[model samples]
Target: MKCWCGKVLIIDTRRLESKFRDDGKDGLIEGVNLKDRIERNMNASSYPFRVDDSCHIFRFTSTGMKTIEKVVVFDPLPIPGIYMLVLGDFDEDEIDVGVKSNNRDLEMVLSTVVKIIAFFLSDYPDASIFVEGSSAARNRLYRIMIEKERKNWRELFVIKGIDEDTFEVFQSGKNYSSYLISLCKT
Candidate 1:
């Protein structure tokens, strides 16, 4: 299947299923160094998270001025090995990506999302994750965060920025409409 960035992805479903079954025996797939995933200098504090049976959804809570529930979903795209990283507030059994929580914990919330990404990649190392903000402002926020930690993340991930039908290696000063990230082949 062709991803939005025009890259073709061919996945082996049987291999993925077998790997999942083997690693999920304990109800969790392990293989990432969570402590090293985020930069310490960035105030990268995170909340505890819970994962659903399928491991596609992760839930956590944000606390500051007010308590707000949040969820990160790894929704699979039509292509087998491609997934979208969705971050949103969980409200009344629905996910509202555009909701402004006003919780005053953007760093912590983003840290939690990064941790979730680490966990998800541990299970599907070869899979590509697509990320785009719900709005232009949010997109800028994401770009800023990525720029701040680009060097720190380079060892673990291959990050590509999408600009109008072109995908290029992520650069600090360049702005991108979206991003694609995958585990770096060792």
Candidate 2:
């Protein structure tokens, strides 16, 4: 099957902060990283933050599609902090978030992810998105994807436990589920 995904672009935490700084935003305060601010606010200097809150915007250009790939954090996220967007052929749009251990960032990135899909839908012609997460986290991933799809596309996008489940639910529609998860050593 021809994949709807195209190019991938990762905007890390540092980059987002830099963008905010350049854009004259204020969320990234005091030149201090969000992770540090959270830690300081809790008065737990060594306390680990929940997860890196980053935006994963998917942009479909007239040439190719683009998506986020990494998050730069001081205390690196235990989740897939480093993501390598594997470009695929016309058959599928593959984004391999090389997750060696846990997938804490997966859920956090979903909100931004949906918008990217929306970009594809509203902006691109006959556009769709395909997600491939590890089986360990596919359930949660599927849940979030499904919720977003349902809200936007109604039953038009039935993302279930896996990609197949999603495909089975709504065939010939926007297939937005994962086929496999990535395992990284680094």
Candidate 3:
């Protein structure tokens, strides 16, 4: 599928296991890193896609402010799959989410990921592109931002569950999300 963001993309969200590797002195694949193979086809002649494997933690300035206010760098995880699992926060009311996704075609996935991110770019946006076993699924959730719903929407992230915790994090975020992470195994 192709998006009007001057890029063409494709997603093949197939459940696959790969050797997990990270940035360290010794190069080794410790355990099997689960992945959903989603490929993005970029038509742009030159696009910068070197910003992968970086985690951004969005912290709020206020106690109950929606959306991401501040972003911070955090420790990199060994795993790759996009785990939206919730961890207890320093403050009980606050919630912390760690995001990471295993990459097969890094450029394509990241490019397409930028488009999928548009879904959360609005004040009240409801849409999701998911990877479900070798295919991309698009669910027109709530009121859409764009006039017409995306017909050729592609999957950028392969997720496990759309639980309440995950929903809360996404919904609470303003225009950007701190829970999103892009990881690369070097």
**Best-fitting candidate, scored by lDDT:** 1
CA deviation > 4 Å runs, candidate 1: 1-43
CA lDDT, every model vs. true structure? 0.73, 0.32, 0.25
Residue ranges of candidate 3 with Cα displaced over 4 Å = 1-53, 58-79, 85-149, 155-186
Best by the TM-score measure: 1
lDDT of prediction 2: 0.32
- lDDT (tens digit, per residue) of candidate 3 on 1-186: 443565865633231101112352233311112111221222312111111122122121222222221222233244443333121122222223322222223233323333323322221122232221211111211112111222222232222233325433233212222233222112
In terms of lDDT, the poorest run of 10 residues in model 2 is 43-52
Among all windows of ten consecutive residues in candidate 1, which has the lowest summed lDDT?
Answer: 15-24
Model 2, span 1-186: residue lDDT tens:
222364454424354334433232543222223323222322111211111123222221111132334322222223433232222111123332443323344433443333333322332223233445455355455555555445444422323224544434432334344422121112
The CA lDDT at 136 in model 3 is 19
- In Å, residue 75's CA in model 3 sits off its true spot by 10
What's the ranking of the predictions by lDDT, best on top? 1, 2, 3
| Stretch of 10 with least lDDT, candidate 3 | 134-143
Q: What TM-score does each of the candidates earn?
A: 0.76, 0.33, 0.19
